[model samples]
Target: MMNKIFTYSLTLAFCFFSTVSYAKKSIEHCEATQNTTSGLSSCLDVVKEAVDRELQTWINNQVFILEEFALATGRRAALDMFKRSQRNFITFRENDCRWQYLAISPGTGAASAYKKCYILVSKSRIKELEVINP
Candidate 1:
């Protein structure tokens, strides 16, 4: 009975560790696969997609708050200003990331750099918007 229990426990522990190791390796596989431009671009695309989703969520929340504020306060101008500010911010983000991309060479790291810049800026904007409440 003791040997059987020990064997089962060891098997369970091994399986658990094996699963954890595989999970980590799968996550690192993208960056570990190759150092090629395309591989890096693909990784950046994944990162950008995640950041874009987060940004969209924050934007949605902010818009909802602004909408409620406009209705409650009867100040449509606030919402309008927010819309304009968002547009201007988008333009600025694009221009800024383009500049960052251009700061590097054309082929190698520019695309990744641009995407990274977008992620960083979008996250910062989310944090900024989080401070505003209805």
Candidate 2:
């Protein structure tokens, strides 16, 4: 009887953990894989697709500009910083200026130190726009 109760308790604990671990969320997103960011690959692709569809600029131009800036003098660190902040934009556009519009580049850096998924957009491209955290 004791063994039966012990086994049941262990089974119950495992089931609870498994269910909570596999939950799908919106604002709170986690990788499908175990502690790895590989699952976020699809999420990043979706974000880029949405950006391309809504924006008028050609994908070539956007990529070229991002590359150019990434190589320019005194801007490498800034570009890296932005990339690190954006986390390849997997989390979605942080500012959400569809009316004004903004461009992006793909990478694997987290948005912020405190937040795992944060998208950092260029303030220059977005004139009169403020990048505020909520």
Candidate 3:
């Protein structure tokens, strides 16, 4: 059973990585832009949108897979758990970004810091979910 689980997890990870490899360039480009000051906040906003879309796509795919699994096995708990985990992740991102914002308070870089935090955290979460979920 352990071997089976490991193999399944590995396969899911490979698929997830393959899907997101194409978006890596965009992610890298946005990371590169983080240091620049020319309209940095607005630029981060756009990048955040794109990153958020990627995150959403990943979540949707996971949900669909979980739903299908539930249908086949009649084990609906996994889908519910996944939904809860996603909601918790959102709350975590918001609170974490708020902390990032506060870390730069009384400074002009606060907004950019917040947005950058969101992008970084969201990207990290995407990679994390890809590894952890089917």
Candidate 4:
């Protein structure tokens, strides 16, 4: 009975780990296909899309918090300021990433660099937004 229980436990553990490993590999498969420029572009696009979705969610949360604050405090200007600041931040992120891309040559990973910059900056902004209080 003990041996059978041990074997079953081992099998379950193996199956669980294999499933997790497969999921991770599926995500990395895009980066693995980076043998060509287009392949790398596709991988970066996937990463950028994922990060953009998360950023959008965070932005929505921030807006909601600002709206709640405005409703409670009877001050709409705070929400307006938050919206304006968010717009300005978007412009800044675009220009900054463009500058980063231009800093590199025309070819040779410029696009990837820009996409990475966007991902990093947007993720940082999401973290900042997460701390807002209504």
Each candidate structure's count of clashing pairs = 0, 2, 0, 0
Steric clash pairs (candidate 3)? none
Q: Encode model 2's per-residue lDDT on 71-104: one tens digit a residue.
A: 6654676545555644534244444433123222
Highest-TM-score candidate: 3
Reference-based lDDT, residue 33, model 4? 62
Between candidates 2 and 3, the lDDT winner? 3
TM-score of 3: 0.73
**Candidate 1 clash pair list:** none
Local accuracy by lDDT, each model: 0.69, 0.36, 0.75, 0.70
Consecutive 10-residue window with the lowest summed lDDT within model 3: 21-30
For residues 21-41, write the lDDT of model 4, one tens digit per residue.
444333355567678877777
TM-scores vs. true structure, each candidate: 0.70, 0.22, 0.73, 0.71
Off by over 4 Å in 3: 1-38, 132-134
lDDT of 1 at 121: 86
Clashing pairs in 4: none
- Candidate whose lDDT is highest: 3
